[model samples]
Target: MTYSSGSLINQKKWILLFHFIIGAIIGVLLLHPLTTMVFWYEYKGLIEFPGNSPIEFLIQRLITEFKFELMPMSFVFALLGGIVGLLFGLYHIRLSGQKNLVRSLEHELAEELPLLIARGESEHLEFKSTYRWDVRQQRTNRALESIVIKTIAGFLNREGGTLLIGVEDNGNIIGIDSDFQTLKHKNRDGFERALMDTVKTSLGGNACALLHCRFHDIENKTICRVIVESAVEPVYYHEDSVARLMVRTGNSTRELDAREAHAYLSSRTTKSFSL
Candidate 1:
């Protein structure tokens, strides 16, 4: 999403400058009278009502010579400077927020990658060795595809999460080699296409849009990363007469049967959040 003025990257210096100047203008307009009143209250009572003493004469002379009250530069500069500071401060906050988000993803990818896999599953993550084809054993297991789809559908139904294909539940990055072997292209691209096709057939085109897939080569194995965004509406895996609806709960994917599914869907609690 683009901001009010420019692209997030590339020659964006002008955008910052623009924001600062605009902020300064707004600050001046908003705070000028308020600041002036504050200074007037603070100084008028002090300077105008100097005590009748030796120091009073000196104070009177100082006021006459400096005319500090009449000098509007102080208020103008303070107002403008404060606005510019706030402008940069807000921008820095935004930039830092984005940086932290990226850092979080990087951390998630690296931290306990093996340990987490060994620990088994969680609400946000799941691991699988193959999609439908077994690379090492060389076999087609259609049930495996159902498991993958059901998990993905559940994830979409809930918080939306990561599904690592080619990694066993034991945290092994076995990769999608089996699926790759069966592919005519024998590549990550072919594997991703097949995965997408499966998703399309089971979850529909709109649901497919919520999914993003990438291939990562770690330790000479190609692990497929499937980042599923939470579906705005309900997502179901439909094939033949049966449809599987589930949600990721704790370390397991819980299939929702009719009575439970109806109560859950009827509650409509998931609407408050975005993917």
Candidate 2:
């Protein structure tokens, strides 16, 4: 969950260098025309030349100006560009770190998914029969989407967990075909969009960044696995203007009262609530 200082420093140096190079190139490209435009605007009526047309006169001036000022102006512009690049790089360092951490977690989870499913639902794992289909009613149930969001919010509010859709509580691979039937696209891409939209709507846009969803083919069936990372701050599930705090308690998700939520957040700063 934490990155070393050395790696962070190295990443920062590379990002800064990359941005500086890009910015310098942009500056060099813009310098000549920009300076030419300024010069034309400042001295357009004031200067006279021996060309037949204004365009020809401007071209002659541009060539003359380039010969005299290009090198010195390029250096000034490149330095200014580099300083701007450094500021942008510094501003995005934390975001870059978070993205790297998320990618690392996703890679690890992809490799360990089968083992995690076989181990059954635990404090960090839970399985659902379908994303939005109700097997009992044999119909598309929109209410189940709320359940999915609740589980995701629970993981975000705790030490994080993985939720496997298209699997039964007892570890059966049922596939998400029934759920797909309810979607307009009726494919994996559509399902992912729907899932993420639900998370974004209920848990806020930032919560979507902490989640990584992947699909697997096992026993000729497709399964969706959602790996959630512990949030840096408290995440609340909003429903009908009401925001509720949910957390993973053993193998189930539970809602907390205001007092309990306050205590939980207070203690979370000093220690993790992972069991």
Rate residue 10 of model 1 by lDDT. Answer: 35
**Predictions in order: lDDT:** 0.74, 0.84
TM agreement with the true structure for every prediction: 0.57, 0.61
Assess candidate 1 and give its lDDT.
Answer: 0.74
- Checking candidate 1 for backbone clashes, the offending pairs are 135-178
Candidate of highest lDDT: 2
TM-score of 2: 0.61
Candidate 2 lDDT tens digits, 151-178:
9999998889889999999898899989
Indicate the worst ten consecutive residues by lDDT in candidate 2: 61-70
Clashing pairs in 2: none
Best by TM-score: 2
